[model samples]
Each structure stands twice: as C-alpha cells, then as structure tokens.
Target: MSDEERFVYDGAHVVDPLGDLEEEGEKSAKHNRAKVGSARPSSLLYTYGPGAIMDLPQFTIMPTGLDEWDRIWRRRGPTPPRIHAPRLRDVVRMTLRSPDVQLCPYPWQPKKHSRSPEGNDLGVPSRVFPQWLRCTGCDMLGLLSQFDYRNTHPYRTDLAVFEHAKCTGRAGSGTRKATRRTAIPARYLLACPDGHLDEFPYDLWVHRGQPCAKAELPALKMADRLAGKGASAVIQCASCDMRRPMNEAQGEAGKAKLPQCRGRHPHLDAFEPKGCPNATRLMLVGASNLWFPATYSIIVMPDSPEEKASDLADRVRTALGDKLAKYRDNLDLVRDLLGMGHVDVTELPDHDLELLLQAASVSPDTPAEQEQKLRDWDPVDLLVPEWQHLVRPIVGNRAEEPKSGLTLATRELGPGLRPEITRVLAVERLRKVNALVGFTRIDDMDRVGDLPRRLAPLTRTSRPAWTVATEDRGEGIFLQLDENAVAAWEKRVLDTDVWHSHEEAHRRNFERRFSETAEQVNHKTRLKPPRYWLVHTFAHILIREFALTCGYSAASLSERLYAWPAEGREPSAGLLICTTASDSDGTLGGLVQLSEPSRLQPVVTNALRKAARCSSDPICAMRTPQDPEDFLHGAACHCCVMASETSCERANRFLDRRFLIDLPGSGLGFFRPHG
Candidate 1:
C-alpha cells in the first residue's frame, strides 16, 4: 500500500520543477516542450534511497524525507498521529524478511482516491537535502546552509545560484553578465564504518583543523591540474589565502590525516550530541562501499498437514459470516480496538467459535518449542518438504495451475556422470521477495543487525516496524548431490596438507580485509567447509556453461547454495542457479529448457572439460593456496571458473576448479575418474 512520486525522463529530455532539459545540448530546442508526471513502480527511489546523490538533467539532487514528519503531524490537529503497523498479510507476503524493521511512507498529496471517495487525497511528496553545490559558469563553490528560502510549497523548485554576487566569470561577452547554470553536488563526503555520514569538512580540510581569525567567511574554488588524478585536484580558500590538495583526503595516510567522526545523519536532519571515536574516511559520492544492503531469504517448502493449520484457519475465516470474518484474521488487534463488551461473541455458536479460534492460532506450542523447531531445521529438512510438494502424482485444481507462483518438475539423472549426482529439479517459476532490512557503509555485511537505529524508522518518534521490499519472479534449476559421496570426498580433502594450507590462507585473507586480530578471526569469520567449496565451485562452472545457452547474461543469474556440514548430522548438498528480475512475468523459459536431460548432459560435460584446464593453465593449476595476489581462489580466473560477483554467492571467493576437475598435481577432485 506504500507509494511515492518520481520524475519521469524520456530518452531525449527530463522534465521537472528543475528546468527541463535534454542531454546537455543534444535536444535543447525541445527541452521545455516535454511532458512530466509521476511514473509507476518508481524504482529509481528504491534503487537509490537516502544519502545517494542523483545527477538530474538541470541540477544534482539528494532525496531526503526526514523533515516531512514535522509538516505531517501539524496537519493532524492537537492529537498525536497514530502510525499503524502494516497488515499481517503484508508481513508474510512482502516484508517478511525484516519483520521487526519498518519505514514510514514518503509524504505525498494525491488528487483523488479510487477506493474511498471522501478519504484523504494526497500524492507522495518528494523530499531532498540541499548539500554542497558548484556553479557551472563561475566554477565557484557554495553550501546549502548559506541559502535563505521559503518552505510553504510541497516541492522546492526555486534553488538557484544568486547569492554569490562577487563571481565575475562571464559566459560569452564581457559586457553582459553570465547566467549561472544549475549547481552540481560535491563529489566527496565523509563516512565511518559504523554508517555515519556527513558533508566533507571542506573548511577544516583546507586549514587542517587550524583556527582562522582573518575572515569569518571564506570563498572556496576547485582547481583541476593537468594530471586529472584526485590527488592533483586542489581546493583553495581565498579569505585566509590557504590551499589544500585533495590527496590529503584519500587512502590509508589520508584516513589517518582526517578528523574524527561527528556522528552526522543528514538524512534524518540530526546529529549525535556526543561525537563518535571512530575515524572518518573520505569517500566519493559514487563509491561502491557506501551502501551494502543486508538481506535474507528462504526457499518455499511444504510441511506436514498438522503444520498446515494456517491454511485451514484461512478456510474457516472464509466460512464465517462477514462481520466475524472481517476480524477473524486479526482478532487480537480488533479485540484491543473494541472492548469485550462491544465484541459480541455470544452470537456465534460456542463450540464452532472455539474450534475456529484454535485453528486461527497458528502455533499452540510454547515459545521454547517454536525456537527449538527453527533451530533444528536444516537445508534437507526445508528442501525435502518442497520436493514432496513438487512431485505430487495428480494436479487437482485445473484453474489454479496457471495462477500458482511456483512450477517445478523433477527427474533422475542419466549415465556418463559420477554416482554423486542424485536428482535434478527444474523450477519453471518462482517468486522471491527481497526486503531491505538496513544498509551498512564502509563495512563488511557481518554486523548488519547492529546497524544505526535511526536509519530505518516507521515514524520520527517511533522505532521501525516495517521495511521496503520488492518481489522478483524467476526460473531456476536445482541439483541434489549424494550426501555419502560428498562426505567421503570432503574427508579426503580435509586430510590433505594443501586443503589445510588453504584454510590458513582463508583465515589470513579475512584478517587482512577486516583488520581483525588473529584471535578474533576464528570466531568472527565463517570459514567455508570443503564440501561447500566443491558445491560452490561446481555451481559457478555450471552457471558459466548455462549463460552461453540460457540466453541470459551471467551477471543476471545468481546461485543459492544449500549445504549443511554440522557434526553428528547427515550432510546435505544442493545448488539452485536461477535468473531473477524485478518484473512480474519473471523470465523466458530458456533455463528450464536447458534443464532437460538432452541439453543438461552436454552442458555438464562441457563445463567439467572447461574447468579441467584454464587459458592460464600450467601457472594457474600450479598456483598454491598462499599465492600473494589471491589467497581465496585456486586454479580459478576470469578465463575459467570465476564468475561475476553478482552471480556468485561468496563474492567469487572460496572457489577452486581443482575441487571440481582434474588438475596437474591435484588428484583429489570429487568428480575425477572414479574407476
């Protein structure tokens, strides 16, 4: 039910409150003639949320909805506004991943509501944070805090560069004054690993945090040198006659030279009263490490009929009369809203209502029992139930077949492969809902749960109760491997000195990246087991082969590894390689077609053959676990087993083609000549 407004842009021009324009003079004559309106699925806002600076045709903008709360609460009169939780159904179907987290909808002023004639009619508003802007004509610098503007309108369309009257730079003729062009956002910002973001300390940067009494206000200018490197770029302040190079704000030495973090959250229009001790690092606006979304997902599975009580409860609710049916799903909430005296349960038959209430309660077990149930669940436990649902003998509801979100088919494998290969399941359809729980800046995604609390809130005064999410429909191929064969091969690999050395190399690589001490590395880093390595490597090799015939780019395809190597438990080995898109129709059936026996046999053989030798062969095959350049991968490179990071789950690490195929001096391949 959440929605937001976004400016639409055609191939030729962009139209908005900011002066309409084409691609920098390509179609200038038709710029002002283009139409503008809000577009559906407004994915731009979802892709680039708060803290991201977007380059619009006229001006650079940073979308921020933090101050909208003050405007909204005032319109609600003297009483406090209520922030209702999203319906329970929405939690299960859409925002289930981050059940505890929620975000408020961006304020908007819609013209009309189709469902309710007299209800509130306001479209979602677009909020922006005016940070630093640079004038195009004079190339002079300015800060948003220096501007004086009115806030009566829902949108700010009057942003311009007029305060700097001293700027004498001209456009064409010396006699006429130059009209300054739209301002561009500053390219650099300061951030900490703990997700704190602030405008770059331009004044302190140029002066090295030294006191300046000569001038209260300084004029800053950006100068580009012939080298064009960031280090060569310089910022000069005219008031005190001081200039500093951009090089003093980058890399390890730059990080050390910078000031401590001030704990600024520009998106929320707030700052921590007490400063943070974490060292702030200078990062470009477009740096990849700025935002890393933390997400979790589970494969759809069937369960025992006893566990299917929710479905029965849904049927019972439908059978009940309209008055009772309305509140049947959320009886607790309705009961709280209307006192026991108002809710007349005596009207319903006592015995039937009791049974209905029992069925409505999804779990009769205690909290301890529920926790144990989830803890004992494994890959096999989840997958077997799904497999059972797929291989049912008969199709009951003919009308429901087309509407069902999932379509799956399974078959036994043919000869010419190792005995470890068990069954293959081709998933023709799948619906995956990925909810954005929270994001981290300049840090590995390990401690995502401990993110800053103010980042994802349902309201200004309350904690988050829901999160934004998107659903992706897709197709995939699943392969189940023989657990016994996997365990035996894993045992052989574990016994080898090479494998032991690789484990050490992995530990070293993690320590170097996260700056973790030796003792911390063991507990913090989740080391990939040998079985996981083999399955992950095989998935990558197959994905590479599938990309050629599946008519999908390798980057569009992603792999999901299902492996459990817990001691005293039966191990499970499976891989699901799928292509997903934000669109509703999912994808073409090329992947499912490739999963057929005739097509699959050759694909598997060709993939194994390709992995047997790399273009960088003898050198690649001979590479040791402790190679200076790559400590995580072995006998793998772009030319062979390595796949795009988007396609691989483990960031393209822990992969060794040697684990999947025969390599020189490596006789421990799981699928090598078994005779």
Candidate 2:
C-alpha cells in the first residue's frame, strides 16, 4: 500500500474544505484547515493517535495532544459516538488508575451545514510538525513560516503543500531565475529514550554551538555529499565560513554536541515539566522507531458470562424483540432479507429459531446497572473471561445468550483429529475493541509488562480522563492445545539446557535495556514459559501457510495468545487467528469456512511439515538464541518464522521453531521430528 493509504481504512479520502458538503453526503466538513488529507477514526488509535506525527502526501502533521483538543470538544454539538467495550475499559481503568477513564472514537466536526462559520472545524485539530523546512531546488534552510503555502485544488486537500516561492539554484546566494519548488522537512530530528522530541539544531550545529556573524538570521546550506547517505551531508554557514560534516553530530560525538533534552513533546506543543536529564539522541525522520503505541485490546464477549445466570438471554430477547417483529416465524429467511448484514441465530446450532420460539417472548429487561457490573472486574487478568467463553459455550435458560457483535460455534475435538490440538472454535462473527493508553518513542515497549517505564503520556504532564479507541468486526479461528501434552512437554523441557539457554537469553536481553529500573514492572520478557514460545511460534507458522494457500497475507491476520498461568486455573495454551477491519461491517465467510475440519487438518499438517526445514536450513535451523548478540528467537529466520511486525505480538521476539519441530536433531521437537 502507498504510505498514506496504509494508515487509514481504504476508500477514505482527504477531507476537502472547499467541497460541496451536501453533494458529497457530508452535511459539514472543515472549511478553514483545508486539510490535504484525512485519516479514519480507527487510525487515530493505532498509527496516528494524539502526539503522533502523521506524514501525509502534502504535509507532515502531528495530531495535537489532548491539551488543545479539550477546548475544541467543549463546544461540541455533534460529537463522536461513545463506544462501550466493558472488557477493555476495565483493564485500561485498572492500568491508568483513573476510574473515570472512557473510551471514545475520534471526534468529528459539527454535523450541521449552514452559511455561518460558527463550527466548520473538521476532524481532530493538528499542527504542522518539524518547524524547519528545506528548499529542494536550493539548499537554503529555514523555518516552515518562511515557505509559501498553496492549496492547488479547491476541494482536494491532499494537493495542499509547502513551496519555496523563489529558488536560486545556487543555494540562495545568487539572484538568478527563481522557480517554485516543493519544500521538505529537514531530514534530521532529535529525540531521547524518555520520549522528548525536538528539531535538529541546524544553526547551532554548523557553528558548533557558537554564534556566527549571521547568528540572528543565519544562511545555512545543507549540501549533500552522497545521495541517500545522511552522514555524508555537510552543513555550511555562508556568513562565518564554518562547515561541518553531518557525521560529527551523530553517535558518540553527538551526545557532546547536541544539547541536553528539553523534554519537549512537539505533539502537545509543550516542554515536559520534569525536565529530562539525559542527552538527546540524533535521529532521521521517518525512522520506524519514531512512535510506538501501547494499546490494550480484547475480544467483545457476552456482557454477563462471568455471572451465574447473567440473564443475558432475557436482555438479548429484549434487545431483539423490538427488531424481530417482522421476521418472527421465518427466521430461516432472515439472512436473505438482511443480505449478510445480520447474523441469523439459526446459523449457530445451539441457538436455533425453534428454541427461541418455544421460550417466553421477553421477560423484564436486565437493569443497565447490574448488566455493567458483570463486565467489571477488579483482577486485571483480561484473558480468563475470554478463554472461558470461547472454550465452554455460555448458555442461558431457553436459548444461548446473544450479543449483536458475536456469533460463535465450536467444532469440538472429536475422533481422528491431530493429537496436539484438542479444541477448535469457529468464531464466525466477532468484534474486537482496542484502546490506546500511551506511547513511546526511540525504543519499543515490546511486552506489556514494560509499559509503566516505557509509556509516554499524551500531554506534557496532565493525565486525560478518556482514551481513543475503535471497535472492529471480523471472523477468526480459535484453537486450544492439549493440556496433557503441554504439561508433559513443559516438564520434559524444564531441566533441559535448551530451555534454560532460551530463558537466560530473555533475561539478559530485557536487562540490557532497563537495568536502571528492572524492578518497575513484572518483567514478562524474563519469565515467559516454554508454552508461550511453542504456541506463539505455531501461530506464526500457520498464518504464513494461510497467506500462501488461503489468499490472505500473514500481515493481514493478527494473533491473540492466551498463555499466562493464573492461580487456581487449568493449564492455558490457546491462540486466536483473526482478520479484523473497521470498514468491512463484517467479513466474507472465507476465513471462517477454512476452520472446517476437512480443510484445516491438511493446512495444519502442511505448515508444520514445511517449517521442519527452512530453505535457509543449516544456517537458519542450526541457529539458537545464544549465538545471537542478545537477540531473542531460536532456529527461526525471516524465511521460515518471522512474521510481519504489525501482526506478530512481541514484535516477533521469543519465537523458536525448534520447539515445534526437531530441526536441530536433539529430540526437542514436540511433533516428534517427522510425525
């Protein structure tokens, strides 16, 4: 996908401020900002949340932090709909310790169209990022204010861009024929591990932090010594005749030359009050590690699964009673009438229309207060409730408890199936909720356990009451590993050197980064069991196979793992492979159909057989976590195991193909090498 196209859902275009609002079906949109591009509300929580740099085709913008957004929302006539994700809300509230925490989609402008300009403000308020800009035609460097702004199209906002009105081919030193050229953000940026970001000090760097004759208005020229090579560039000042290679301001020398961190958060337009003590590190813009969001997600579950007789059947009957009058007797024909929009209850075996017809019409609806309490939890283990609902079907008095966002069925572990996998669940229809708590820059907060130390707040100092999130609809397949096999394998591997080596590698890798505050969080990376690596690796393997045979790229599908051991609970080893999208109200049945016994059996066997030996075998299969320099993963490489960074949890770390198959020939493979 094109860079701009990848962030938001497909078909969403840049909001043109000059367009006919009524003609396009939008009653109102921003007329002032003339935003050259637009992002969907879901994208706000993922790639472009508040305090993230949104590099669009026309402009490099940062979603203004919560500080400025609060004022704009105060006048709110028509605001974004508030989403209810009780499972996710419970976790986020527990994490942030703010009981009033709410989850909301990104706000939209007033939904009223009129001649008055009282409220024409468009999507989330944003500001131009990287105040500095460079003229491509001439090497002259200056702030963005010096460039001329232009919106080429009346309604196509993506065409709006910054341009150097006049260009002297000779670095602005000559008065020759001048032509307009698009301006780009200066290549370099400064940031620290603690999440402080600032523009490269171009003026101070060329002069070595000393003022030149033209210090007030320096004529800085950034000349390239080599194309696509940052260090080869040279920054020169025309006034003082001072020049320095860009390499001098990088690596070890950079710490001495670059100023101490100002604790600035450009997205918030404020410097942190705590005042960072560490030296800022030099970085190039568009680097992958620039922003990393720490999000909490959960599958939407029947709201009252945990309670004894949640009365959810009555609640769903009440909810459906109003809408069911027309299709009362002929539920079989409901699917044809709804045209794939509605999930018919008859599709699930346990909840057929006949059963619903035999029960009472509708009892008193469950109280909203009591209904919410079932979704609430003091304990923060988010996976238990979901596991119970997925493994054991939740049944009500007459018919199964129903949720509009979920339709599920189980293809139980029956005769003549693979011994390793004991249960398979076909989640024909599912909804997932995601919430953004905080983000980090420069380095990733790989495991959720590291969140406390690594998370960067949205604002400079203040804590916001609510978080931005999105609810997605899709389908998936859930598989549970055999408990006996998993327990026996853990026992067999517990004393082996291979398991100890992998465990030690995790400790060393995690300690290498946060030795100063290792005790802050639980240190999940240091304590992951062998079962985690086994299940996580299998997910990667199966998804890669799914990509080749099922026509879905591994990147498009994501995995939700359930491996942590909670007190007084049975051994947990289950993973869900799902494809979710906000635009697709619900997905086609292709993914769910693949979960059928006839199809999935061969796919599982094929994925394992292929992973038994990588094309890069010997070099790939023989490798272990010990040989690498503190890097995690064993007997796994890009060719065989590594998945897309977006899909794999832990950013593809802690994976070991050797556990799944005996590539090393030491009798460690759980599948018995060639079984």
Best by TM-score: 2
Error of 1 at 406 (Å): 1.2
User: Which residue pairs show backbone clashes in model 2?
Assistant: 14-38, 36-157, 36-158
Top candidate by lDDT: 2
Write the residue-wise lDDT of candidate 2 on 420-482 in tens digits: 888888888888888888888887665333545457776433335667777788888889988
Cα-based TM-score, every candidate? 0.72, 0.80
* Candidates' C-alpha lDDT: 0.58, 0.70
Model 2: how far residue 364 lies from native, Å: 32
Output the TM-score of candidate 1: 0.72
Going through the candidates in the order shown, the clash numbers are 11, 3
The 10 consecutive residues of candidate 1 with the worst lDDT sum are 1-10
Per-residue error at 672 for model 2, in Å? 3.8
